[model samples]
Target: MTKLIIQIPCYNEEATLGMTLAELPRQIPGIDQVEWLIVNDGSSDRTVEVALANGVDHVVSFARNQGLAHAFMAGLEACLKAGADIIVNTDADNQYCAADIPRLVEPILQGEADIVVGARPIRQIKHFSPIKKLLQGFGSWVVRLASKTNVVDAPSGFRAISREAALRLNVFNEYTYTLETIIQAGRQGMAIKSVPIRTNGYLRPSRLVKSIPSYVKRSLLTILRISMTYKPLRFFAVLGSIPFSMGFLLGVRWLVLFFLENGTRSRAPSLILAAILILIGFQLWMFGLVADLMAVNRKVLEDIQLRLRRAELNSNQKER
Candidate 1:
């Protein structure tokens, strides 16, 4: 009987909140044993009332709209405080089926993985949007390339995380935090797996498409930031190689031309440009090495602090 908590983050989703809450207990037989936490991200509608009316045990409300990432972070902190051993994050819009909870938690229960993401196969659904399909495909590829992890759905909202994994995650911002989490987990060698799930029809048309350009820009920035934070060596090496290689090739070409023209002078502009590019590349590489050392030192400090905290906990338990 492992303790589990189901966390839902809502934003003015009053229309479907009641139905979503009611369906959860019906779909999962052991629902009584699980805690349901609903995070109201400054909903202007009756979302909180609907959740409370539907018998939600825990509710966290924000005075102002803080994006999805903040809502999820709040719900996660509440779940952890409630002594949850496993936490599952789902949507309040009734997009994910509650019946899939068991499947999502299986990997965590078996100690096979730290995080399990529920991936919806958009192709199997009827009336799938081609634009969404393309974005998902592109986003998946970007996540794979950036993290080097075989995650199929980095943007999926439905996910289950063990207590340890949940505590380790510190998402401070919105947009692409999920992708960043996957990247961080991969860097830490945490096991991750995906479970198949299905999404219900949206109550209203999604505004995601309208924000594609902004989303893409933000996602790329987040990926680069994550790379620099956790895998600086790889990040700098990849970026540095481009300019370095270009400069090297240009320099070689200039030298070959100079020699072929009977010891003529090299192209001054080309030589200067090549020198600048090479210098910039060398600086980037050195910065990455320094960043890597700093990251290592920070991790060591964190480990030491964790050990101290554990010892304090043990002492407190003995006194009790």
Candidate 2:
């Protein structure tokens, strides 16, 4: 009897929370053994009341509204503390299907993966906005390139995390937790798998979508941050290569002009630009090497802690 905890994080989602809770038990027969956790992210509405009225197994409330990432972190910490063998995070807006929970966890149950995500197939949703789809595609590409893993859905909230993986995760206090978690899990050598699932359109407009530029900027910054942590060499190499390539091309043109026209300097501006670009590229490459060394040392320290934790777990299990 593996204990599973399903955590729903809500913020002013009273209108759909009841419906979402009602559909869960009906959709997932295994709900009989599962513990339901609803985190009221300081909703102005009756989100907490609805959870209690519906007889959810547990509820946690925040004093004030925190971002979605903070809400999720709190829920995850609660789930781990409750001795849940597996933790599933879903939205409170009823976007995700409870029926797909089993599919999401199947890989984890089979010992094939530590993290499983429910990937919403955008093609199935006729109402999905083109802008949302484009953003998702671009984000997915950035994650895949940075992590060097084929993860189709990096920002999906519907996910199952094994107990071990949950304990290992240390999400930063920011909206970037989604991408950060994926990268961190990869860095920890956790097996990650994705399952195709269908999600309904948002019942109401999401606050997240209101600021397109902000969202894009945050997402790109998160991606860059992850690249710096896990793939510093690649990050710096790409950064350096851009300027170096441009400078080389400019310098080649200058050389061509100078040789072809009786040793005359054709473009002094191009020469200066080329020199600046080349110097900056070299500096970037050196910075990358230093960052790579630091990353290696950090990984070594993390590995030592992991081994110690594993040993403690084994000793405790033997005593039990």
Task: Looking at model 1, report the run of 10 residues with the lowest lDDT sum.
Answer: 24-33
lDDT to native, each model:
0.80, 0.81
Hey, what RMSD does candidate 1 come out at?
A: 2.9
Q: Which candidate has the top score in TM-score?
A: 1
Q: Could you tell me the TM-score of candidate 1?
A: 0.89
lDDT of 2: 0.81
Please name the candidate that would achieve the greatest lDDT relative to the true structure. 2
What is the clash count for each candidate, in the order shown? Answer: 0, 0
List, residue by residue over 16-110, the lDDT tens digit for candidate 1: 88878876752334333687899998999999888888888899999999888788888877887776778999887787888788888888888
User: Which stretches of candidate 1 lie above 4 Å from their native place?
Assistant: 26-32, 207-209, 301-320
Candidate 2 on 1-320: residue-level lDDT in tens? 67788899888888999988887752334434688898888889989888989878888899898888888888887886666788999888888888788888888888989988788886566666788788888888787776666678888888999988987777663774678788878876789888998786668776665677787888888878877887788789999999999999999999999989977655889999999999999999999999999998977877786677557656655675
After the best TM-score superposition of candidate 1, give how far the Cα of residue 180 lies from its true spot, in angstroms. Answer: 1.4
